[model samples]
Target chain A: MSFIQTLKQSVGLSTDGLTKRKTVTFGDTTAVGNGRFWSIISVITLSMAWYLGSALELVNPIFWPAPSAVWDQFINISQDGYRNFTLWEHVWASLYRILVGFALGCLIGIPLGFAMGLSEIIRGWFDPIVEFFRPIPPLAFIPLVIIWSGIGERSKILLLFFAALWIMVIAARAGVGSVKLSKIHAAYSLGATKRQILMHVILPNSLPEIFTGMRVAMGICWGTVVAAELVAAESGIGFMIMAASKFLATDIVILGVIVVGVIGYAIDILMRKLEDKLIPWKGKA
Target chain B: MSDLVVNDVSMVFDTPSGEQVHALENVSFSLKQGELLSILGPSGCGKSTLLNIIAGFLAPTDGTVELASTEIHGPGSDRGMVFQQGALFEWLSVAENIGFGLTMKGTPKDEIKKTVDHLLETVGLHDFGEKAIYELSGGMQQRVALARCLANDPDVILMDEPLGALDALTREKMQGLVLKLWKETGKTIILITHSVEEALFLGERLFVMAPRPGRIKKEYSLPFAEAGVTKDPRDVKADPDFGAKREEILNMIWEMEEEIMGQAEE
Candidate 1:
């Protein structure tokens, strides 16, 4: 008998097999379960601070409008249409550009990244081109994309795509390269084909990074959408903000900024949820 | 039915500076079906390099590895390997990691699930099927790695210091587990480690390798491999021949180490 096994058995605990069975406690009636208490306390504290801040006028009132004033502006914008576009229309255009561009980026970048990950030859061929092009920011491509695709939806979408693609490429490269060699061998010993090794062993192992890439790409997607609108758009939040800036309407510009922030936050939350769903093992990470 | 024949195997790796470094040379060995052989050596003795070649992850420059009269050119499910590091897929659950090979081979989902559960149970991790790799401690992660390898049901299990990362207590426990599993599964096992005590305790025959183009310097048939040898590990360690054999192997390794380092200086 092993020394530890004797000791554990002496105490009536068993460690006879490959695993030791143990019981664990979860968040049933613990301090972590006090959702109501936490929710109420946070709201109370935030409201008190807001009330005090409004009375003192501590920040730029026009730009950092009071929460209640911002709420009012939100409702007002929904009610009032501007130049054949409501707040929702502006939101839709911005979100459309981001989703389309981000999707295009994934379509191009994911395959390219895996190709580079699989073979040194592919990496050697592409690394130079990627390094040369990636250093220049996607917004910098605005002038060039305009020259080629014109200042239309194509140019705007391409700008967003280019921005998101570089980030995804970097993330994917890291993911694939980081997969352990032993895992690949393990798969090979299991009669896995080359494609099987990549799809099952390499790809699944690197999912944490792949999801990180998606999150980073989506964030870049939003920023690119805003930049794309700033250059040429009649109907995005960036256009709305720029148009409002011309009229010295700081409240409207702040509203546009708020809209962009909320949209970015919402989509990021969705991506996190998707990551959790796809890789339930993420909690370990 | 599954047996290994490694014939006059030798391996060499060249440094980036183009210097040829020998790892193994003229190392020949063969294992009968279900034989458990342990390789004990000093560090840098190419034990792992030899094992990798057998696993088909590396190619021997001067010899061939044949399994059941077939030349081994690449990895197959016929030769499972357990790395010192667990290397479980971080993003996969224990069951998914265990079933990975099956999934890759297009096994039916139900069959894969059944085999994964059976494997988890065999490895004594039945309830850990849903757990993630990181959720387990070091020893437990190694068990998960074991289950993953066994789930593939290979003809041979090549372990390269599989318990080297664990604490002393866990390593001993895992050694027992490995022996028990090897017996029950009836698979040919080739284990490589630097620990003398481990080799004496676990191996039917111990192969002592020397460094600097590692070659099998001595093959010791230990008393523990005798049918009279006790199953208890402590008893095996306490056997009269244990200390003498350990000393002899240790001296042989030390001499090789001095020779290799001297060669490097020259």
Candidate 2:
């Protein structure tokens, strides 16, 4: 039988004489917890709150940037551009840097993390170096990155790679370490090779932690992209914010922050969805 | 029944402090291939050590164990070991755990599925092959562990108090299942236990060991297992030689323990 047939049979959908077919009836309360209506209602309520607060002058309209101010600023920036850069150009530049840095971090960090997790010798050598650099903020490295790589796109990406590497490596290492020795022993007792054990035992066990780290990295990278642009950039949202501030275009600054928030929130939500789809056996662990 | 001979096996564990503690001292015994034998002793006895040595997880300091013409050195597919705790892989489903040995041997996926299905039925977990290890009861998990071991169809099954962790009720139920499985498979089984009554009910011949510098002190040949099995073995306990053997073993263990303590103090 195929996988689906096997699954169906195990759940007692097989044509067995002793199978019990019980029907479950849902109550009205189930719909409330379904989340669809709740989400729409929350969004509407938040929008109304933003409008009312601006109308009432409860928050200073300049610093807070009322919805109308932010909307007008968005259209103006899209149409006329800022510092020889269109809004889309800035968004694309920042997004590209984030993706490249994240991919690079994962490439280098994950294997090193696994090595550190599995071998005490690796942990002993690398842990001190990790700790020494980890406390210094990624923004602090901005000066050296600019000097070494020049104030080009490369420096901005290197900043992000620096920001993300330690977090991913540590989370990955922790994830691998948390896997029980019994699981490894089980594979060994069954005569699985070392590579086989790492692929099946270590990788699967480390997945939940890896997903968690990715979510955090995405959030952190959103902030880092802006910081990366602050030092020197001909394009990007961070460059837009710094340039707008010189002209006292406060509305543009708030708009840039909100865009960052929205992007961060959307990416985090996607990360959660990926977690749900990948580790479908949550009820077991 | 292939005879298992332990030719002068002694297991002396050397500590980092340069002191040697004997876990098994020149222990020798032969087991009928399919006979269910239990080794009973006090807490510090070498009962489990003997099983571990036979499983090839540890080597005996001064002897060898042979299954017919084959000498056992390392854990192999021919000897299956069931630990006290059912060490089921958390991520693998019941069928996957059972099929693990086949997967390691590079057996085709389809053959693995068939063998896993057959073992699941044999272990009386016919419908649970897809369920997670955590979803099963303590008893059910042990059953899956057994099926996993049996998937390789080993000649001898070594159990180091496999039912020791269960509650009394589950333990009794598991005991019944073990006897049924033994009867069906006719596989040689070496059971290590601390419970005298459990030993009486499981072992055809009870081997008694002492704790200090642990060694096999006595071997009692008996037809107790079949008689003591069905919960009406009160009279079997009162058999002329049964009480005498138990008392003699108990006295020997006590003497050995004191001597060991004296040596340790010095």
Candidate 3:
């Protein structure tokens, strides 16, 4: 057996069992009867373990807040507000920044990527600058962005924008580049003009890759927005967390972190649903 | 005048190692209206290169291809080509794929639908019109490809090893379909194949090509394709004359392979 098969067998995973595990972990909606049940059970188990650990006082409450304490902090923030902004205001502010940054990245990156994929000259022009910025961590640019654009909302949004732009461009370029040559030949033989081939053949074929790029960009945008808020922000979930940390309100900090995680997960799920609806022929093609 | 004429076509490729590779040299042929011609050769014999040149996907280093006395410049609706595999757009439905050519010409939506439906029936894919390209089997996909090419009503249909990727049984079935379509439409067809049997079965006129500065080594006018239209392909193949011709062609190709092997060893 190969290493992967041997490892799976050693872990008591038969081929059928591995398939079932995949269905459960990846949320295969068609297999939801069993998968949904298992997913709920797993989540409940984790929450129980966390609650029990806190109740048993295994860690100091100052650093590791109990579930009830976090819940209380959540209720308190919702009712009394935090740092002059209500709970909804903090979430809305963060969402607004992410939307602006991600939308800008997509609008610019998709067209630029297509231009580069279609022409060697355009690729040469943009490739160097894109390559230079792609690998640099979004947080690393915070100092430069603040210096250049100031510590206003512009700097924070710009950080998030830069994070998403390169990923979208690379994905779109790869999508266009990988279209089969035979497909193009077939279209040409059928009397399709250059414009028609671009609109019909290239565009639909590249959509799945572009959608994947959008999802990745959204994730990156969320991370950069939070990190930007942590550095300097007047409102947002990141600001709430940073402010709570300063006052040693560990419960509030934990609540803020949980909220961020939950919101990010929700967004990811929504994107996946949209992908299924819009690009139903993705893997089938 | 012939329906299509290819005169003194030659193709040369400049290798990265500063060598000039002669892909095709002094190749010429003509096809009458409604005639079916097959080019048979081994790999590297430039049969495919010649087909590409005729399809207007490549410009020959010298010479020209003329249709009805008009010089061919590039790919156009006058000539349709069916590729071996991976030609169909996987995202489109079978009907949409067949109607693609019509859509490009701005055919009315209802006319496209009517024509696509007619093609779907012709290809025996009546129930598969709404199905995605990826859902069809290999033979079915090739059938769709043929129907797609036919939808444009081109004067000439170029098939480059269209059945090369199919299994033996499916290949046989597809051969019957090709012959049926050829008889029904009466369009000029130029098929390229490495299969000696396929070449004999499909071509009314055959060009046997050789490699190493690829050129036509011999030509044959065969009755198998005409007989196949009326009689069973198997019975046609089983004829004494067919058997003799098959043996002769097979021996010629075997000798060519041996010569290639000897050159490689030297």
Candidate 4:
């Protein structure tokens, strides 16, 4: 029997006389089909409509460039390049800043989070700083970061770092805080020392939360890098698109958007895959 | 010999509203080295608070818990605890969880393996040593918890409703396993449970507690736990004396619950 029907019957609702409707409800697990098929179909249909509309000049080419025009812009930039640097250079510049800033954030934020979660004193000292800055957008910091560091690579990377730092700290702290009191007590009663309990019980337990935080931090870093580059930076995808927008190079702008979106999506997918492999017991417990 | 002693233990919680809640009041008991004691009480009766005090997880406001004549200042390996659920490390396999205490103490790998294997067999989970905690059924998880607690070879084993989450059949079988392990290992056990029949069947000595300044209201020494070792628990529970005792304790707890409810309404 279907789960909903069984539930209804158990709750004393008459399933005997009523006609069974083969329809999906919001919470019906059995009704949840593989959504991937629909996702692919929607993408295909949208692309066809876009291509057909562009080919027939349904709208001005300046405002909504065709996919083919974007493709051509991609090839044009790949060869002759956007500005003096090649296409890869712009992509590489953005990626390098994100990786370096994100790496620095994780390096500092994770330990800081651990400290905060483990000690009341540390939490009290740092809580104000984190909580104060957490809600403010990375874009808000761009102006201050530029003023402090100037419109250089340091400014862009620093903005990305700040964007990621708060998220990683919160994630790591939550991971440590989420450890069950029972698990800790059990470990202690099992004769584990404080250090051993931290290493074995608390660390492993917090990994799922940490992974989730990393994913969120990476995504925010991607967005912050672009915004930072948009505001400043001489070379990056954001710079490329901003430079193109000046001359109404809509095709190049579209190309840049697609590339950034694809990479952002790919990074999230990769993080999810890594999370699955490393922490198979993520939500089970 | 009295291996464990609770000396005038009382736990008073101060609410944020500046109200003092007497969770436990002047509770005291002592157990022989291999005795099985089950504590039965309604909700908010400080049964768990008392157990936590004994386990050294909580410091009672005005008492001391000593095991083997030494005061328990904090949680140590000499005392093991099995919780009802979610106490096992989800990241670790069944064997890893069972051998966790030994590993923490830096025991040799071969010895940990040997002990873990033996415990797997003891708990009837011999083939499930490599399985993750989430993959196991609720009953199997509790078995893992039991084995994990036993692996420590502690002087006392404290269980807080260890089989509470299991279905009826699983709970019955686990109760039998508890009796068997208690008999074979000869370790002192103090189990807190809500089920009256469970208390009667598994506890050689049963303590029924009252709420609102939780204290031991009555104690009964039963033959059912020993009798349950060799014979079927069902048959032992069917005895007239067992039924009579179960009824009396049930009535006592029911009255206490009623009084607490009536007070709450007032």
Best by DockQ: 4
Model 1 misses residue A46 by how many Å? 11
Per-residue alpha-carbon lDDT of candidate 4 for residues B8-114, written as tens digits (9 for 90 to 100): 99899899999888999999889989999999999988999999988888888898898999998888888899998999999999999999999999999999999
**Candidate 2 at B102: error in angstroms?**
0.4
Candidate 1 at residue B240, lDDT?
72
lDDT of 3 by residue, A127-225 (tens): 999999999988899999999998778987888788888988998898899788888888998999999999999988899999999999998889888
The best candidate in terms of lDDT: 4
Predict model 4's lDDT versus the native. 0.92
DockQ-superior candidate, 2 or 3:
3
Give a tens-digit lDDT track for model 4, residues A1-285.
Answer: 689877655544543332347454568665554555557678899999999999999999999999999999889899889888778899999999999999999999999999999999999999999999999998999889989999889988888889889999999999999999999999999999899988999999999999999999999999988878887889999999889999999999999999999999999999999999999998888
In what order do the candidates fall by TM-score, top score first?
A: 4, 3, 1, 2
lDDT string, candidate 2, A189-264, tens digits = 5666789889877898788888788888878887888877866887888888888878777889888888777877
lDDT of 1 by residue, B146-185 (tens): 8888888888999888888899998988887887787778
Q: Name the runs in model 4 displaced over 4 angstroms.
A: A1-29, A35-37
TM-score of each: 0.85, 0.78, 0.90, 0.93
The CA lDDT at A129 in model 1 is: 86
- Cα lDDT for residue A113, candidate 4: 96
State model 3's lDDT: 0.90
**lDDT (tens digit, per residue) of candidate 1 on A65-138:** 67777677678778795556788988888888888888888888888888898889999999998898787867
Give every collision pair in model 3.
Answer: none
Q: How does model 4 do on interface RMSD, in angstroms? A: 0.6
Pick the winner on DockQ between candidates 3 and 4.
Answer: 4
